[model samples]
Target: MFRSSRGLYSHIPCPVLPRCRLPHCLFNHGQQHQTKQPRQAVPQRQISNSASTAGSSVYAGKGRVSSSLLIGQSEINEHVSLAFKGSAKRDAPATESTVPSATPTKRARQQVSVPLESKRSADAAANFTAAEDEAKDSAVVYILPVKPHPPALHSQRLQLATALAKALRDNKLSTTPNNAASTKELEIASRTTSATYANTMKQHIISLGKRGKSVEKINAKKTNEIPSERILEYIPQLVHKEWQLEENKYLTALPSQNEIEEARAAVASGYETCDRCTRHFKVGAEGQSECVHHWGKPYRVKGSDKKFSCCGEMEGMTAGCRTSPRHVFRITHYPRLAVMIPFRQATATGNNFPSAVALDCEMGYTTLGSELIRLTILEFPSNNVLYDSLVKPIGEVIDLNTQYSGVTSVEDPGIPTFDATMNTVLAKYIGAQTILIGHGLENDLAVMRLYHKKVIDTSILFPLDNPGLTSRGYKRSLKSLAFSMLQRDIQGTSRSSTVTRSTTEGVISNEGASCASTLPPSVVAPDALKLEGHDSIEDAKAAADLVALRVKFMLALEDQKRAGATTELKIAT
Candidate 1:
């Protein structure tokens, strides 16, 4: 076997350094090298332009390293960068420039060429190692000297750098990479991967958040059901501003002589404004063929472009996708509205009035326009029905709108007229000071043409929780409030007829409609619930209960404040 150059020069002392740290060094140091006086080892980590020129491939500034070697058994001193590189080179075959006069020696012939990439990589590794050691001793880059990693981890770091270099060369680079991109990939990867844990992970920043509990859940947990009567006390305090209505745009104006005559002519001609399409149509000739409308309200796509919920088509992009069985209408003009049931100035607040009342009205399509079909009123806190009736409309019936109104023409003849029922039935229970509570109370008040001060409209009472939903023109619905706060379900396909009374059987006469004196809300079985659309009585009670819940949450907050104050006082005293 041919002797290698490293084996031949194994006994030679390194020329520049007084003590050779390398094991099995390769350079010839016989008579030719012995002529030079030995120099001291570069003062621990002291880097200079000339310090590493003779024995090291790397160069550094006036940098220093006070820390000991981190390379474990394969230790590199102050010149770790150069020491590591020199050691690696000695282990392999030695390469050199050709001496013109000398013949090629056996040792020289044994030399296998090293790739440019390999030489650059070795030099870079040496430089990085030196810089890091210098950074620790001088506090130039890093102030603190980090504890050396376990010796076992060095090989993994090397392996990771190798992998990263391969990936950089193979993929991540552009058509023409940066000038320094060739050998620096390993340095880049090494520097990045050696990072200590971030403060978020190391400093223990995360903690548990408050658990969510709904109003109903909190009440059940606390084991204290707030009294319903407390609703009256907090009603004024809990009422938020910007929700109270002062005037009436929604109320139909009382028709004058001209409006009455014009309305009479319009009725005779059978032409009325189509509430859905906004175009006038002949009621006598009303049919499904000509009418088209979106049954659902308008909404937006991704909160920008407006569209109808029924068809998901952009508004005005096409005609209504849903064809009605028959065209229905509603009257907004007071003169036209008054012709059906003359608009009445609601009796002003007076001494004899329930502190609060929940009012709901149901309507059906009529020849004059939309007319009141049913009205329900429940007193607050107690939730007792102040009034409940199917008020007979004077206009020729067009469509009962029974899908929602829960009224039919079969009993329309026997029901009380608008005049008799409002004057006698509703007048008996309601007075000036009554605070009417209902979701979307404006629509009900407008349809009934009953306006009074001191109102608690739940639609405006509880703003939608999400500002995004509010910006998108969404109103908080009563169903969500009842389910969330009270844990009660109302306005379904079927419900109890007491609160769930049958729509068919509840069509009482004018005399019976006026006799609302705490008549126990008839509680029929769920099977007997005949209400097809929404129940006015159920909705009224829901609105009332929701207000009661607000009072309860207030009571809870008050208790919390009182408890906290007491605890602090005790601690101080």
Candidate 2:
């Protein structure tokens, strides 16, 4: 049966299965019989090289089977049927093998054999072309160039003045009019008339000369005709009855002891005072309060045997151990003679006068040393001119100090006398309750011989304290305060021009005198000369403006405090 099966299978022309051996011939026959035909073409190159050997073996085995098989009709019939089926399968594989062999494998071989460099070059070229196409399709942009503006034309007079100054400085000309040629040259270059130019030049020269000299020399020269000491007997008596009447009419009443004590108490309570050191401590709480007085310590030099005493008086042989209290007081603590001055409130009358006023005074050298030459007062809120006047000195005129006083010539018929300025100009605007504000107000008040209780001094407001030094009353300049706090530039313009002209006009108008008697020079001239001195009116207005700014800042701070307090109260509730 096995021989018959092998003979039948070999004659059936099955695919060369060399792996099928006689030891497992039955399994091989069964597998071959069960195998399905392939659906696709099997290329001749894809077939194994062992196929030919297997095919030869199969044919040899078939020959053996044919030779060994017993001759019978049934067996012949079975072999014929099986050979027919095998021929059908062999025909299909033959057709497929022939189809692949006819065509060349050139396309497949080329795909596998391409060089790496050629592929990389092709890929790079494609990428670059694509990038170029994208760039061409994008939009173009252009930037426009900017043109610069032309320079502006400034003041011609200022330019000429500057040139003249430069020329004088270069020539090393002594600022005194003693050099007539230099003065004339400067005047001509400055484009000013001889008379006007001469006066300005002479003043400038004298100022420069005086600055170079000692204070004693300058004072001696200014007061050459007058005595160094106060000559009370030499002072001329008030011959005019109007002056006496004016003084009597404008005299302010003194404050009582009760008001003074109340003011002191208020200051002690720490209102409006610098509490930088004491603010952290509970003022009156036990074990928390700090001393208000400034203390001084004894010091000994590096190699000295003796020790320096404290500021306080020395007790026995040793230096005083206790700290000394300074006699410092705020402006608010000062007692005012005027009663019931309104605090930043307008008066009941329709006069529209401000509650506070800022004052500035200019002094000229006289037999009594420096005396008030001009006084200017400005209303606080409105900054309106309350009082502006040129006052004749109480004693014999020594020097006008026009370089600083801004009083070029004090011969105006409309200018008020010292008595009239105090009574009519100042008294008309200021009340007992009015708060007086200024820089270095004590000096101004002393020169004016006026006693004002409610005062606001910028010097006191912003003290220039040098903690290392023992000096306590160091005051800051009004210019510095205005520049730093108010962001304003003041006292730059010459006071002689603006102040003198305005003051003369104001005095004339106040006294109802003819305008002709106090007419100012060309308005343009004063504007041009504004570079020359300090204007009392301008100074007063500047001080007032500073105070107003301070008031606004204080109000803003108060508002913030109130808002914070209200928020805290709401949370507490």
TM-score per model over all chains: 0.51, 0.35
| RMSD to true structure for each model, in Å | 23.6, 39.8
Candidate 2 lDDT tens digits, 4-81: 444544445335464443432433354554565343534443233212221111121112112111121232223333
Point to the candidate with the largest lDDT: 1
Which pairs in model 2 have colliding backbones?
Answer: 175-205, 176-205, 336-453, 341-433, 494-530, 494-533, 495-533
Per-residue lDDT of model 1, residues 57-168, tens digit only: 2212212333321322122233444543453344332222332112323433223112211343354456545543222111011111111221213344334333333333
Best by TM-score: 1
TM-score of 2: 0.35
